[model samples]
Target: MFRTPLAAALLFATPAAAQQLTPAEITRVDAIVADALASTQVPSASIAIVRDGRIVYARAYGDQGPGMKATSADAKYQIASISKQFTAAALLLLEDEGKLSLDDKVSKWVPDITGADRITVRQLLSHTAGIQDYWPQDYDFAAMEKPVTPQQILDRWAKKPLDFEPGTAWQYSNTGYVVAGMIIEKASGMKLLDYLQKKILKPLGMQAMDQDYAVGPGFPQGTHRFALGPVRPAKPAAHGWLWAAGELAMSAGDLAKWDIARIDRKILSPEDWAAQETEVKLADGSGTRYGLGVSLGQHDGTPMVEHGGEAVGFLSENVVLPEKRFAVVALVNADFGGAPGEITQGITEIFYPPMTTQPAQTIDQARDALARKLFDQLRSGTLDRALLTEDANYYFTPQASADYRDSLAPLGEPVRFAALGKPRLRGGFVNRNYEIVYQGKRLVAITYAEPGAAGKFEQFLVQPR
Candidate 1:
């Protein structure tokens, strides 16, 4: 899904050498979002960055489409399995209270489930329990009716089959998390949502969050969709079944607060936070991979903790780098395309840039002036595609180029880019072309065909180039 890797890469030298990122670093951060906004058809998105127990950046962009195309520092996104860390944290809080044991079997909490008699609480949090994800569409819908309750999920789904004998292997299973959420409920004698709101959300100052799925009324943005294609009335996930898999929403503002709170140990004990950071090993023990719901990896040389979310029309990622004292969160409203967790990781490299950089335009004044003039004409469509036509010398990264072609394939068309001369476009959506030109060391124009409207050749490029 990574069409192109960023030119900006972070070289983690040492924790002691780390400090807040610079202005240049911030430019890279915004550029990553800009590229995604143009390439992906996302209508709206929110991003937040927190560092050293502080919210350094919290921003939003794009229109809400049917609503207002606006960015909100207070906009809340339904962060899917990225919710697992909190789910695990909730369970651990109970463990600290002596109400449950990390090693306790699921049978103790939900005694009705026969298959879960041996799945331990820690195994559920670590996703080591052999359980199947219920939402995969392969299940017979005729037999499955209506939304399920917390206990119903354990009894109906958890009893299906283990992905492996307990702790023998690892397969991401939403079923394990449902069990963890149940443990929280039974141990606390509070509904999972109520307990989380009281202990986690409120304490962290995250007031605008909710996992509630249409309780007695309709929502302004519609209930969460289970799928995002050309499908009708996108399937809304069963409320209780969501459990710890997904269903939490919070504004970028609130998330920034929560990120700082984690650093402060405001909601979780130090020992529990340490355990959450412990690297979870793979089944065959080849790699110490996942920890609770988070992925542990390296960028340059810095250790990273991060997770992504997917629910109906929403796609998102939240990342944390304790060593760097930095974190980034991105949430998109539409979720048809691939939105990998690494996207945020990639953006982070730019937000907190390293010394050794890769770019054509450095910190220069003249280049910036030229770039602005060139982009202004191109964006306004006053210039034509003739100035920046495709050249044999210029080739995109192979994957990015291929993706462009694939997307165009739906329209069964080829776009001809900027051409030479006065910049007139030719052909239709099915067959079109353009050209890009640099006139005598000056930026010129780019002209491409307009698919639907024929005989109307748009020409925007008109510069000294």
Candidate 2:
């Protein structure tokens, strides 16, 4: 019933500060991947787990052949929808330059766009715009012998009716991001790739990444060569056809660096970064809970901003947990499997294994190796328990810049618990708490948190009655 989907490495979102992981600790995730590959049907996959800023685990199995050996973490991948973040980022950067606003009309850039003027940039970024996806409704899935020019693509859907009235609801429209890419091209007077490289890639030190699809004609996105992998056995894919949506190729090494950026607030400014975290309101006039290019969610109850991708013969993902200071990049050479998400989810499970009485440091160590020594001291019963004594009055997490605990109950607390001087039952992880307890040899924990209205729950460990 459970299907689907962070760590030490980078995020374009900015790298966060935390601890690192040792190679032995990193391999724990690797031990389980044989099963992940068999179940997901992925030919070959590479996964990286970064805790704080260091990559704790990375490995590859299977063939991602590009006239060579099996694909490894260093292989280049066409990360499908994940490219939307890049398209979205270019727009945000332009907005920062005052090139346009999220509320700006598309007609401002795509003259003669018919109803383009009716759509706002905000709608485009979040796929709330009413635009029809450009890939023909009966699009030739197997091949596009002829490349569709930007104008040609817009034309196919020119007379096509929108899925709905602008901003009337929420729909996953690739056309929205396609339009966004076009606007970036129109407004910047540069090819999608050139502009991205100059503005985003080069600045972010993404030297190994490129926006080319080996298929399709028209537009020379780039020629930066890297290893490519085959899906099954025949016909290799060119990167051009992916166009603006998912054409970029990068090594896991470089991708790791970018994930770090997401945590560190390096490439984008603090305000712009914060803007990326704002959730988009759904068509129902309720929030759909996604940030600009980021999706606001969680990995083991920690705040995560991430996105997934699947296009043609490969799948890719980038998941980052800001509060936890880690990110993950999982890429697979498979067109139809769910390896990316599965691989990521497995890695998360290992890194932040469900809380047990095994000791709090075990969880902390899963996230940051740098914390292991300190936690060891605590575990060895060597460190003065006095630290917890003096700090008992304060919540363990470093004081938030603002109160994240406002009026909320804590998680895992009621074997019988209290909060803010009130007798309360914390229903979920939204603000749950956990107190270490010894429960016989099993040492299992009782949980109070669930993913909730706010999308995150505070994991709590409460003392049993």
Best by lDDT: 1
lDDT of 2: 0.53
Per residue, candidate 2 scores C-alpha lDDT tens digits across 380-451 of 334323323222213222221012222112222224111221111221112222222222211111222223
Which digits, one per residue and each the tens of the lDDT, describe model 1 over residues 150-241? 66766766766455677776656677787778778889999877888888888776764455452222221312211111211224454554
The models' CA-based lDDT, in order, is 0.55, 0.53
**Can you give the lDDT of residue 454 in candidate 2?**
24
Query: On a 0 to 1 TM-score scale, where does candidate 2 land against the true structure?
Result: 0.65
What does the lDDT read for residue 303 in candidate 2? 76
